[model samples]
Target: MNTIKRNRKNRLSKLAVVALCTAMLAACGSNTTATTSTDSTAAATNTSQTTAASVQTASLDLSNSKVEYDEDDAYSDWNASEATTIKLNGTTATVEGTGAETKDGSVSITAAGTYVVSGKLDDGQIVVNVADEGVVRLILNGAEIHYSTSSPIYVEEAGKLILSLPEGTNNVVSDGTAYELADASTDEPNAAIFSKDDMTINGTGKLTVEGNYNNGIASKDKLKITGGTFEIHAADDAVMGRDLVAVKDGLFVIDAKGHGIKTTNDTEGEEGLIALEGGTYSIESGEDALHSTGGLLVSGGDLHIAAGDDAIHSEIALLISGGMVDITQSNEGLEAGSITIAGGEVHVVSSDDGVNAASGSSDTDGAAGEMPQEGAAPADMPPADMPPADMPQDGTAPADMGQGGGPRGGGMPGGEGSSNNLLTITGGYLSVDAQGDGLDANGGIAMSGGTVVVNGPTMNGNGSLDYDSTFEMTGGVLIAAGSSGMVQAVSDSSTQAGILMTYPQTQQAGTLIHLEDEAGNAIVTFAPSKDYQAVYISSPDMKKDTAYSLYSGGTSNGTETNGLYDGGNYSGGTKVVSFTAASTITWVNESGVTEASSGFGGRGRGGDRQVESTQS
Candidate 1:
């Protein structure tokens, strides 16, 4: 009798009732009536049909092909009351139901049901090989599984699988240093927990995964994580999904030799995706911290990462709507083909480039560029007050100059194809301290609203702002400080005004540089991370034909500058000089070398002035 009931349960669970209802509703019309029935019977049948049709239609529409998960569609029917309990001890396994089969050192689940698994498996495995349309839920209640030659848990065949870590439980899954599959035709599992179908992990417990072979957790299809506390240490990626990886809420700490979180599917129309709605992540990786081949969208999170390569990389578009990201160490802070920041709080400290928008995806093997040797700067860096060896001192292009009258490799290189890559900043608060270019784009840059502060490279090989095409700034506040070798201003299409000024001598780090209006109101105050000799300021508050003063060693008093109290307010300071509105100003060696002074839409060139010598 029990066997008959178990078989019946399996058969009932395998029926595709939702799909059948959808097909039936599509084959019939809403106004159809049974003509041979009585009036009451006809009315009752019509009402039933209408109700069933509406439900099926709603179900089909709700399960769209979006990367994000819908709770009602995927997790509404899970019930823990009817579940199979399995206990394991060493190489011995016991199942309390007829849905699971136990062999020598492996337990295979062949039916769809909720399962409660506990106990420690020293050298065994739990394999889920259900029917083609099965949905299984495995609840870990103080379970620990370790396999010496393969993955601890492998999902071979299933429509959807959910791994639940119940409250107050501590679960662990680990792999060994080597693996050998029994059947050569089976797909090899390279992670501690591997799944071939859609998988979801959620619970209130703590889970630890140690991947001695490859990845920590890998899903071939969509993978979603709603809740948990995870600590993962892996040889490869800590968490990887081939199709899509969506995280709603979690607390994760990852230590990886490869990428921390990654997606690598590159199908033409079905590439991989990564979406983060809410989480708290602290990652230390030898490669990129977060990477995707298709697209990456970050709406909310708190990310603190230290990476050997780029911190955040995307082959396609990368969008950041809201997050608090702090990248303390990276070669490139944020890199993408197309980058957009609508709202966020980002701070980056980089060795090569702070924010780079380029064309192609980076190599995932951490071998793109040669890393700089420890305690040594990059090659070809010019000293202060000097130009590159090949550059002419008269501001004239050399015979081997590249396009745009700049030196070779000074601007964007030619013949890189027509790149549609762009950096669009709508709203954000960004700060960058870089040893290379602060903000570089191979294509155009459009800034409508934002606040940017860049302490760019002290060397002459890079610039504070570098762009290939037009740079249109319709709104925002920008303060750029660096060496004055390859400086460019916002185009004439900008509505706000900009001033480019070069100081006579190099200002040491921690020196406050302040700008004030005629009424002694603070306008801009900045302290460069490195020594600087030039500054470019632009904002909507800058008016035409107004006199502004520059000061050094200043202490501020009134309103703050961009919510920063670095240089204090700008009320009282040691007055250096004052100048009227100008298109360009070159103050060199304590002597004013004034060039063409147009209001805001002009260009000029001047040489450095000489200081007078005093006899002691």
Candidate 2:
């Protein structure tokens, strides 16, 4: 690992359901007394000192989910005789009866539930009728006509629409003067306020719902903005609908060319889910400020997202835990199949593949998407010390090395598609800036705790594995600073020729070194030497005589200056060893090289570094 570049190492480092029956109901509001006492402390973990758990308080009564109105049964409160008040508040009404009373004196709803359309209108044209699965909440009180053929109110049947707008007034009103009503030949005038079902907007006034025929609040099911203050301008997919859209609290503001909030599902295994538990959202998007393939879970919220393509795309699994997320992208700030942080406070800037979890295809068992990459190795196959031209070519060690293909076994390369699509961090407070692949994952990464600080570009210019297609650091306090090549652990294509993994090497003098592998799982870890090369081992695939141990560097009074040429320095004593699967080593350390510093400077070597692999 590059050994501590903390700040700017080039960047890289970055549902469901529903059916619905009646018995449900229960969803109106009020309980957000407001609480922001954050003290994450980077996911503190110190088990084995138990004794804490006792709290209680429970009371529930939601009056059958209240959302039932009846001001006189509606028809703008039955004021016929030519009908024309325009708008009114208090008595709550809006009337403009025309053309045989607009197709025979409408307004006849006999309980099918979900209504909250408050009143007061001027160029009135309110015609809401769902008659069935109910849900329409259009609160536009007096002062918002902006006529051009009228659209003061309209929701025929797409059901579940929420326009809201009166907690403090002025939700949105440009003093009425601009207007457009289409009909020439399918002119598409469906949204000044349109619905497809599933819309949510909390109040405090000034609700601006601009339209060009689609998506300011188009719904299919799942549009939830917890509070108020939303500004939307859409031509398509700006707060769309099909599955999910979320904002737990709000001051949300959006500008879209397309996909400011999208949800689509038809192929690639049906995807659609988005979550942002609290809110203060700002989005400028051309596509994907928050796109969903099925799975996006941000725990708290305070997002400032920008995307020309993908600021936050989710194919499956993106779980941050607590808030304050800032993402900017030309391509991908955060892609997903698996990008997890146990807590929150993330900042990402990307051009492409920043925090990706790739898996649009690659599947072998059921054969799903195709499959071929998960540990890789087949396709050209090389690495066992060469020499098959019938001996004597020079460069030593051939003649069957230790007997046939000698890295592991039976020619390696079996196929049934194993598994890879993980990007796991046990806690959080992460910071990343990437040009590409900062925290990647073809399927691997596990930081048992958190306080992660990755600065970017860990190699991918040819030196191999940039930004993790499989990178691991079992514990926390990881600082992979710029310029590439920090760590890579790839073994299991079946091995071929790679060894020498010093996890903690030492013996005699001052004492210090540790090893494991017998259920304990931690093999070779040596620290104390500064100035580069703290750990570096290559891999072609080495594995042979299982059963290794050296618990502590043996008392070799031999000055130990060859620990792979000085990187392991060695003055007095440092060693603790253990091994079960005796051979097969593929270690690396370059991007902020670990051990001498980066955590674990003393004792059981801080945090998580484990190994107990066995197979003889």
Candidate 2 C-alpha error for residue 197, in Å: 23
Tens-place lDDT per residue, model 1, 1-616, is 0000000001101113243233222211221111221212111111222332232222222122134454622323335457888898888789987689889877899898888889998988999989865888888889999998998999989887898877788999999988897775854798899998878988878899999898999998778888788999999899998877788888999999999999867654345667787899999998989987656767788999999888888665566767888899987788765676666888888877788766442112122133334313336545645545664443332344421122312122222311344566667788888776688765545666778888866765566776554456656778878765555555444556666656545678767777777897767777677777667777767775566777777565544543344434464457765766533222211222233221111111222222221111
lDDT of each structure? Answer: 0.64, 0.42
Candidate 2 error regions (>4 Å) = 1-41, 44-210, 213-233, 240-257, 262-275, 278-286, 291-297, 300-308, 313-319, 322-330, 333-340, 343-351, 356-424, 427-447, 450-459, 462-616
Steric clashes per prediction: 2, 70
Error of 2 at 519 (Å): 6.9
Off by over 4 Å in 1: 1-67, 72-81, 182-187, 361-381, 385-418, 557-563, 566-568, 582-616
Q: By lDDT, who's the top model here?
A: 1
**lDDT for 84 (candidate 2):** 33
Cα-based lDDT at residue 100, candidate 2: 15
In candidate 1, position 517 carries an lDDT of 74
